[model samples]
Target: MKALIVDDEQPVIVSVKLLVDWKKYGIDTILETTSAADVPALIRTEKPELVISDVQMPGLSGLQLIAMIHEIHPPAQIIMISGYSKYDYMRSALQQKCIDYILKPLDEDQLNAAVGKAIETYRVEASQALIEQSYDFLHSELSKKRAQRLFLLYHTSHQTSVIWAQLCEIMPAFSSMESCRIGILPTGHLPSELFSGARDLSLIVNFIHDLCYETGQSIASEEPIDRNIHILFHSELSNIPELCRRIVDAVREEFHLFLPLGLSPAAPFPVNFSDAVRQAEDAVQTCGLMYTRQPVCFSHVTGKEAETPPVFRMEEQLYTAVLNGHPSGIRIAVRLCLSDLTSGKGLTLRQLLLFRTAYIGLRMRWIESFRMNHKTAASLDAPPGSYFRLPFRDDGQYDLSVMEESLIADLSAISDYLKGVLGMGPASQNLFQQIEQYIHFHYAKHLSLESIAEEFSLSSNYLSRSFKKKTGSGITDYINNVRIQKAKELLENPEIKIFHIAAQVGYSDEKYFSRVFKKTVGMSPLQYRIAHTAILPPLDLM
Candidate 1:
């Protein structure tokens, strides 16, 4: 486990550093920083398990950092340390999901207790996950029988009494509910090494049972050989959205997997069970295809079937923006897609995640197309396609704000890569104009390949290759030509020393500058100046 301590005060950081012996609590690395602005990059690089952050700080407040950390690393625990005892600040920290709130004049005992509690929570969760993973090997014949009965109730048309009675016997939670909704959690592609062969189906079925059992929900319908697990819940719970979120979180945290859920609207029990199944099936198919973590609830669809726009329509527009290399176009494309998904009411967070899944495929394909078309791109040795996979992939949820941030970052990288590619081989008129203008303005100073590339937000290697391709000369050669051209104008003035002229042209050492001047002008700096001076009509002797 890793821990990060953040504070603006040096003494405060030092004090907190000594407040706890983190190694005893399973924290091997303790990363401390005084600036909150540095926290985001550190969070990405270190992936700390726990963060102790000050409330008021320069750049980002502790509460703000807490929110960022949660999105980037959902499992990481946070303890907010504030000098103020005001209720509003404490309330804000809690709202941000900080694990513990510590007031000014930190109490060693309170701090110790918080760290201990966090560690224990992590331990208990890990143990429960272990149990869930081991469930397939331990389930008995009775479990299999129960799963079979639920499957029969959902699939076959039967008397309401018969199905209700069987459901009550198998899972008593349904007996008292006036109405129930069924949801199907659809399995994704299983890992070959762990989920392969004859036992894979049984294991997946058992995994669903374990998930429901752990979440306090009852498994309603189960086809032992089928890949989807159907769940039953009382319709009366006003917080169905909360329940859905918990289910999604638990499955991901335990099994490191995501199963799209298709949920039915709450309907009268027994009579509506079959109808609920059909609704869930529709949702399942929709969500499974979209790769959303949220269960689709049929009751939420607002638009008429005729008005519903397909997700692929926006996806196509986004694909064009990526290929065209316009950052604003890509942003608009993603926003439109998200807007379409959310236009309907009762939209679960999981349904929103579908937007991510749908576009990720397009994003990866665009990257692949670029790599395949440009041999120069292949030589750059850019990161692999999998490098673009978001951290949310394993966490089984999407934080829209974080997703937006990720999209911008990815697009920036893609835009930069494309800018490099576009700069090569007959540059677009706009790009060529911009590069020339930039070079003309900043030719002075040590303008290396990397500095210019950084200015243009491109990879240095790619920029160098492309610039040579466009201007028919290398960047270094062009810079030298520009320097010599400037040196020629200065040589016409005898008042300026050769050394001063050399320094004025962005060169530090006159000797080296002289050598370049000779190579370009076919004469030494002094020889060129003297020759030009002789040709000039002798200065008026009046």
Candidate 2:
């Protein structure tokens, strides 16, 4: 912004100039005019966007100066400085839409504030002009097209052209890809929510560009279309499945939520641009619950829709059960859903999303019903307009559908993890299971670590890792927890002696048992028995 300081008092003109820290507001050049008559000439010649003029001036009053300046340079914003707290002068100045007024004895903050306001008003007007220009172009483009064609055009009519202008600025040179591979990655639902006030999505656009570039993809453009990014290339497409997998994995790693990366039904950037966009949209939509299990592209191990039997009708009942907090309903829904998978018609990533979306929505509803004080069905933290609400952003973690899919995928990972372990082979896994069942049935025996490890036909190290992985706890820890539980029951039976309880829980040595008991339960067995030794019904031996 160019600021013209106008005052008949030369001292006031210089003082105002020196008082302001114009550079802080991104303004630097400050012009001075001591005479009111000089104001119009200075404004016209300098074309300053802002004018700070003294209300009382020789010959032409500050109001007159502003009027003259306005007629010739309508864009210039005028602010009147007055010696008196006169409402009349202030009212006249404001009526003409002067930027602002500041009384004499100009404080530094006051001058800067006035200048800041004038500059802010000018910037807003300038931005409105850009938006208008973009809008006009779209309207003109629409005018040239037929009615039906108009409706099918890029819907983000406002942000598209603006982003296009930026795209031109960034990729001033590029026709299409011919060398390196390019993957036009798809995002969940950001494109649809762009026009809707969800969040600032510009970073998402750039992130895709940067990711592709860094991942050895010769991307050509960083254009934002609606909410989706057009991952153009200066080359071909390759390992799109692997790219999809990595992308999904990276997203899962960074964001707690999940979205399926689709192979975009088409590939290699020299493709039908519109089709690329359409398939990209499909890829995103494929992230919806019913299709979340099996991936169609590079995204990854998603639900296989073909394998997922059509249980859409039962979804409502399942969801209703969850929303009603009927655990039995949850169990049933889970079993039914799992049974559908048993058909071996594995679900596509999108189909799984459909189920998960229903599940998540139901879970949220159930939580809401318990928090009856709320009116809307959104989460309590996200009730209505809470700032810390669950995500609906196209790319952020914690999107309702994505979060559920991710957690399910993580748990599935645990199962997959177990299945891959060497100990989990049928012959081996069953042996461990048998040994574990035996231990539970015979915990009162004089069980020894060597005997247990030997029973499984495995070295202690392998058995230990296997047991810990399958049960998510070490065998020793589990045994202690179980033994302590049994000890508590025995301690309550006043008919039992502390020494006898120790012997029954597999320890023949009472003092050693006391030491282990204190380590496990923070008390000696005798003390523990004393604390909770009331007589009770005998526990079933089986």
Candidate 3:
């Protein structure tokens, strides 16, 4: 942005100019007007995006100039640089929408932040103006300026043309240039272990913008997401893998802010745009949980277990593992299955998608299982732990939502898939089978402790204790586990209402069943199956 320095003392203007590395902030020309008397005319001609001025001047004090300039350009952002201690001056400046007032003998870091904040405001307003909007008029000259004021709304559409126009308007040196890629940097909620404070993050954010600007890439947005600073940049250089590593190093050395950054794998296809954002978001999610410390791509942000499973079958088993509260089992099972596919070498893109699908599905199922009240429910339902899932469709081939929907439509089918039908063998070879059968056969048949003990030739107390010991749960727990599982089966069938799902699962109340479902699944049972069952196979075929 073109910035104007307005102060009475030429030496202060020169000192401020010398201290600032303008090129590093993509500033081409630093306009100078030492007296506020010259500002109204200079401002009318220059139309600078930002103004750095002293509060006290020989004539037309900064406050007066601000009022006059604002009368012509209400959207202009000004930051008062002052030595004055008067609260009245500060109050007046602040009320006039002075972006920031930096105390003199200035802090370089503070000055940079004030400047960055001012430019950020400009970019956001400009970005918004360049985007979609309708205009209004009152049939007067005032309406013309008001229409111009409509640009105050900020947005992101990856609009290079808008930024290009902005670069021309502000700098003019690169008005005709092209071939820049806008990178939205990760902003907000970084791991506390890495960054010491908000001040530290802010400094780091400023340094990043400086780096990107120096490197011919400009920082776009400073908005926070997940847990890190967000910036946008467009670059001319290649070997971004190495470029990304340097960025992490700069954050560490420049401002003592350690940040785990996710650089989006360059989107080769237009269709991959949304996926690129997911990759960036996924990187933050990993760092927020402190799962990884190195700069990374989203696919590798998690550990080897996160490497997507090879085929649909193994993926389904691992998903069930998540539901069963066996994270280790899911990891190991995934490793074994992936090893079979890749011989433990590494994952191809298709395998990665399948792996992600399995992981999300398992996590989603654990969510669904939580909503039921089977004695087995607590044992079977759990979370995806540190990893959050973001699955989206880029084309017809990437339809996980549809697959999840279909899977929910046939919960029993998914259950069978989990049971290893057509893959591992019959469900009888498992310990879960014993629990599953016991619940199914005994659920509505006076299956309480007393009768089960009599049938098993043991005392009621003894049998209950044994059941709890064997399953890490009580007999009541086991019964409820079965009921909830059955309830899920009934809930998945469109033929049955939730009320019946409750009754069939051995509860007479649908309201109670819904409460249980919401607890486990993080959604209603109906929503769970619908979200998950509408699965689309991997997106590689096309």
Candidate 4:
């Protein structure tokens, strides 16, 4: 990609520059020095892949230059130019591993041929290096996955000794480990779109693995579930706090996100791995309320065990509202439940997440009963395992306002659908209006026709047909229109980055967002921002 030329003659340098087309060989940067003494410093700074030098120079001879280049960057390719064609000179050049030896009064064709060959050689070596790197990465990932599977089997199977033997086969270090602590790290309430793809998930996992390796602590085992990674570490490794700090800092620096890590008390290795995992999970939930990008240990949590009676009461109220088809009561019940959870002492994000899960389950049960009684063909969609991702503010504290808004929207959609089914609400147009409101509220989420239909307990075909007939547009078109409109509003703020805007508006890929924006608004996001944005004059500090 880059080349350096060393010679004491300026005209020769100009002639050599004119003789060959550097760009043709993929050398975009060319460095030239008339003094051989300057070549070493240039090599250090520029890191050229190819070098061409004259045999006779003021300070260093061509042989000395070639040796120095090899010492500094062994992979660099060199071509030697000499006025004399003596056998000794050519032989010495070849001995120092120069790619080619050429007599001066340069032949343009000979120079081009040598340069082409050197470029090709460099490309081949680079490709080989990349292939080796990819192989190593895949090998590492396979080992981690295998270890995770063994861990799961060890927990579930009655034959623990057999699973432990297999785990030891894959990770020999585990056999020698005496005691260990488990740490659960959750990718805290960043946009779900950030981890929706497999590549992003692998990136985060690999980053943690590499970081753990750097600290001289090999992960004994790791399990990834619901945006969380459970990492097991040897108890003797006392640098876990420092390691967690480094991990959090690196993740924040690299992904502009927060990662909360929770640690458990030391337990006997292999035997107590399951209990350690549960303790670590509890630690994460306990500390998540006051999390500030630091590792929280189980021993550090100070609170009485959470009371379940109030949560159960609220659940009953919510079920009653849903069964009675009281849309307003559903919103009221949800708000009250959230209030009770947050107001309780020792309240945890885990509690809120579990409450969300329980609510969905109850709603499904009610829907099933309704279907059985009426002999309707409707069934509730399968709920996501982790639905309520506790939203956070920029300061890394919980954002209850946004969470409440999203909760209200989600529950209201279900209530509206039930209301329609019971024939207690207004016409079909009213149901479409409720659907529009739900789309506006949750446009940033991964929304689809099937997902929306599932939420409302309707078949996808029926929902699609009814929505189009009532709204005069397809459900997908309406979602995209909402997203594009939201994107336009976000683009108005010059401070927000385009990619962040893309994620906020339900499009994970920035380029795809731009294409959709252009198709809808007749201009790319940047152009539209520039056209609509008013230029502000500089602030006077003087």
Q: TM-scores for all candidates? A: 0.32, 0.28, 0.33, 0.56
* Model 4 steric clash pairs: none
| Candidate 1: tens digits of C-alpha lDDT, residues 176-267 | 87888887765432223444553354555565566455443455345445545677777765566566666766565656666666778888
User: Which has the higher TM-score value, candidate number 3 or candidate number 4?
Assistant: 4
Instruction: Quote model 1's TM-score.
Output: 0.32
lDDT of 4 by residue, 172-242 (tens): 76678888888877654455566645437567776776666544445523343456766767788877777
**Per-candidate local distance difference test:** 0.66, 0.56, 0.55, 0.72
Give the runs in model 3 whose Cα sits over 4 Å from its true position. Answer: 1-168, 183-203, 215-217, 220-245, 252-361, 375-434, 437-542
Winner on lDDT between 3 and 4 is 4
Best by lDDT: 4
lDDT rank, highest first?
A: 4, 1, 2, 3
Number of clashing pairs, model 2? 50
The number of clashing residue pairs in each candidate reads: 2, 50, 48, 0
* Cα TM-score of candidate 4: 0.56
- The order of the candidates by TM-score, greatest first, is 4, 3, 1, 2
